[model samples]
Target chain A: MPQRMARVSWRLLLLGVLFCAAGLVLTARLAQLQIVSHGHYAVQAEDEHMGMEKVFPPRGAILDRNGYPLALTLDTYDIYINRKVWQDEKLAADGAEALSSVLGRRPDEILAALGPDTDGDALVAGSIGYDAGRKIIEMGVPGVKATATIVRFHPEGDLASALQGFVGRDQTGLSGLEADLQDQLGGSAGTLYFERDSMGNPIPFGYRQLTQSEPASDVRLTIDRYIQEATEQALDAAIEKNAANGGSIIVMEPKTGAILAMASRPSFKLSQLDLADETKMELYRNRAVTDLYEPGSVMKVVTMSTAVDLSLVTPNTTYEDTGMAYVGGYAIENWDFSANGTTTMTQLLQKSLNTGAVWVGQQIGPERFYDYAKRFGFGEPTGVGLGGEAAGTVRTSEDPEWYPSDLATNSFGQGISVTPLQMITAVAAIANGGELMRPYIVADVVGPDGSDETQPQVVRRVISESTARTLTAMMNDVVEGTPSHGARVQGYHVAGKTGTSFISVPGGYAPDRVITSFVGFAPVSDPRMIVLVKIDEPQGERLGGTVAAPVFAELAPKILSYLGVPPDAPALVQQGG
Target chain B: MSALDRLIARPLPRPFPRVTGVRPVLVGAFLVVACLGLLQVAQTSSATTTGYNLQRLQDERFATQAGVHQLEAEVAVLTSIDRIDREARGRLGMVPAGTALTLEVHKQPPEQQFVPLRFLSETKAPQVKTSSWWQRLLNLLPFF
Candidate 1:
């Protein structure tokens, strides 16, 4: 009896030991599932029921100041082929033939885009018209599908093409204002989350949440359509007539510093834009803001204006011209190399004499000359609200390359570089009573919230109002006194200065190549518009007064008549009659 | 009295009732839990229905926005300056206006009024105003 009882006790003890070991193993597994790998399991569970998708909003449209669309974002379609489904020879042929008919491409071309018969997706046709894409969809071709896409379109057919820039395949701005204001032009994407079934379709009754996308702001540039067209036509005509390499023209509202029109030659047309051609990359730059050239005699306006503002010289301040001024052992002569014996400050400008300009620079000296140049927004960018702007090179006495001759050359717009924008903005300061305003391209921005108009911002006063008026009068003498200058208007007292600067080469200046430019404003009493015309290397008539001034003379009258400014010199017109 | 006789007399005095199996507190707790479960199920059903409706509306809005964009593109094309210029010159036989001739109407100038120099400038024109350094520093304060 004792033995049997002991055997039962031993068996019960063994069973208790086995049960405890199994419980410990179960507890460890439970701990791992609940605590150690909890996050992993939780994410897996969420993946079974939840889904997220990104929603893209349309890009903004670029409009002119008067609400004319220049660049627009329009919905198109991208036709794609499923390579795995197209592996079937019959389905591939049928779909390719069907797509080719609508896409205006060969069947083999479509098939080639599809690639080898494998499991992948390929874009057969991108940015096809909406009507044609819809037709392909209606045909219900096998192994093919059309997805919606947004494309950047220039509706005006290359008008302001360089200014509008272009976009990449992913709908991102690549250049110009489009690249500068990407944040404002590109709308933010949104997110959507919902419960999904095993097949990745939204459940019939699922939890859904959406964050709506913010719409892009419409950018209204200060460009005027009529003025832009006229400027382009004028530049084209000038380039063709003079057989020049290229040119740039800019029209500005002096009072507000609003850019009315900006055009550059040798630019790509929107209809014929081919990004693969690398030779045309140089044409993509907006020369008005990016290219730097010795502004030639145009810098004399700044030099003379600085002297007049400081009471160092007056328009009638007289000086002796020996046909040449020796500075730093170099002889500087007038543009024509035949100096008048006695030249007044007014005559210095009327004749565009380099020797006279050197005399005035001597009065102002280099220290104050560069300071005033900086004040006039030279040696720096105008900050015209564009990308890829060149600040321009200014060699001062402090630089290693400086010589005393640089002061004289720079006095008449040489040995220093300035973008066309800087030249025009400086002249605009004189046109608008000496207040230097920050030039702006965007006039307003209309968004989903409200409209924001860009107010004119004044940088600072570069010169006194009295000095501006005095300089304006002197410039008027330069234009009206020299009727052969080709900048005179019949019934308008136009004030202008012409520049003829030689192109600098590797070691010295190019003997025959010159970049001629004219900067002018009309109705000098109360100037309305200021224009800058720069021609590069004209075949003949290389002087600014002859080549560039005539273009301005042709464009300015049309612009003034459009603005409805009353003629200040009706008597001059009557005399002509 | 004898013990046996006393016990029998006491038993006859009262017949106690048998104890019941259920408890009132437990039953009340179970009823409250069941009601909460039902409410949760109803709420989930309502939410799922609302989500379906929202999804449908979102799709419709997307389609309508796309249509509006299409129409806008069409209008932009039709009203483009290049198109108008071409049509005006080619179809309508129009020419650019000639050099403008102005007819002078001699009239007396308007009488000038004595106005303050400050008021003489255009109100909307940008004005340059200077502030003290202290004022500029104070503007940096959040509540200033």
Candidate 2:
């Protein structure tokens, strides 16, 4: 080629300039993405190849005092269906039918949950056992994935269902101790971050950020497995024998305010519970702590205690009982609608005489009466460390509905509502030397490292020790004086009172419906345990002595012996006495 | 001097000249490259091994945790008191013990009692001789 005078072509120059400018722009854009907005882009990249998952820590176990498990967490799988693939394949088998065989679900139900046209990870089944889940995983089913989740299981079935309670699908406590101590039982969740390789498997030793989860602590309740079973069995027998609708029983260590056992009928097992059923939902509330009723003449325990503590009456104190006493234009009549001339305080408690309770209330007067009621922890919650607790209703002089007749009725546990917990706790004060204790069921919070123990809390001293002794002695006379009343326990000087109050209807009171209850303690000398048995609407025998007292009489001996307490009476009752 | 001698005289082959800077430098470069290549290979192999080991360990940890939870749940179900009672009564045809005559055991006379040997000096150290678990631990001990 000849060296010719080179002419600079403007077109070539323009093209060169355009190329340089384009390269510069590309470099600048690369810098912006890789540097200026690096964190944002890095996050996006992580979202693509990296995965983030929630790691829920294991929930704590609820144990009985003897380290027996009440409620515990188990690992179960949530079976997810790759529905998109199923729909794409129009899966050869009816998926519902296929899964129904393995899952025990109705075909129609399964189909509704896993419809043929569904997309993405649809839940096919939940809470499948580990062995079953593994089998499913090994089946290599293309359209199925199994992920583990936690489920609550009660080892003892319905033994203490209402007390232990259940957890919901979201892994949160829903009721009972489960709800009350959620923070202690439910631990903090954590996140697991990792990058995946080409096969969609997490890359080992590659860019992983893990925040460890803390396991939830375990709860140790004061409830004894044996005592709880005994109470439930006794209550069940009582309900059947009395032909009662339902009932509640509370066994407490009066000395420590520890609820050894609390049981209620119409309870459902955690495993059998179906939240969708409204009828079963009512049984979820622990009636011992939640339900309120006219506690009947059990209020006499408080009434008589008030009078005895005030030195206004003794066991031998007498009151005149006219057939019907008129107060605030209301006639107060006994159950038999008759009079027992002049009644002694001991006879009043044993007979559950309404007339005598009114006279005692009259002697105490309104000011002292209301003050004693407040002192006995009536009209307020017992603070028993349960979820649904009720404060008993009382009409004091301060309330507008105060009636002179109300005082007469309230004396015998009418025109006032109370829970089984409150009644027992009040009577427990007398059993515990008149010191009101805040009742507690949970004994300790245990963990891998250590345990946090629940101390016995005394709310306050309600009455003098001497008063408690007098009342206990007087209560003992009630059981002994009236042996046919069924309050007497063999080989023990039992101290207790019986109560039967009418259930109020729209107007006055139901002729048939009545709440019959017995509140008492055993081995009256040491007073190891106080028991409350309340039966709702006993069929034939409407009186507390007939319906409720026998329950205590039967269960007390077994309970006392089980607790290793020597009897205060003859080793064996005198036969045919 | 003889003409033959002059023809045969090869000046004693100039002693081979001493090799200096250039050749040595070239050889050094080759050696450095080889060493670097070997180091890179070792690093890559170690990383791959570490990654595989991490994966295996992670799987093992998960499996163990799952196993522990499963066992806990199983124990709870089996040890349930109601089940035990039912099995005892229904399957075994058992009954609650009736009242019985009480008996008490008194301590033996001192002459009949055998006292535990008191060792002034231990002759042998207690060791796990048969257990494989202990043997495996022994394998980890440098002194063993």
Which candidate tops DockQ?
Answer: 1
Name the DockQ score for candidate 1: 0.21
lDDT of 2 at A474: 82
RMSD value for candidate 1: 10.5
Task: Provide the TM-score for each candidate, comma-separated.
Answer: 0.81, 0.80
Tens-place lDDT per residue, model 2, A1-577, is 2223233456667778999899999999999999999999998887889977677788899999899888888777888876566664346246556666678878677556766556567787899976677667666565667776888878887778888888888788898889998888988778888887643435657777779888789999999888998899998999998899999999999989999999997677777889999878888989988888998888887888898889999888988878677778888888778888888888888777888888888888888888878877888998877887988788898898787888888888899888888888889999999998888998998876698998998988888898899889888888887857687876778889888888898988998898889999988999899999999999999888889999998888778888877666545523231
Clashing pairs in 1: none
Enumerate the candidates' DockQ scores in order: 0.21, 0.17
| CA shift of A330, model 1, Å | 1.6
The CA lDDT of each predicted structure is: 0.87, 0.83
What is the CAPRI rating of model 1's predicted complex? incorrect
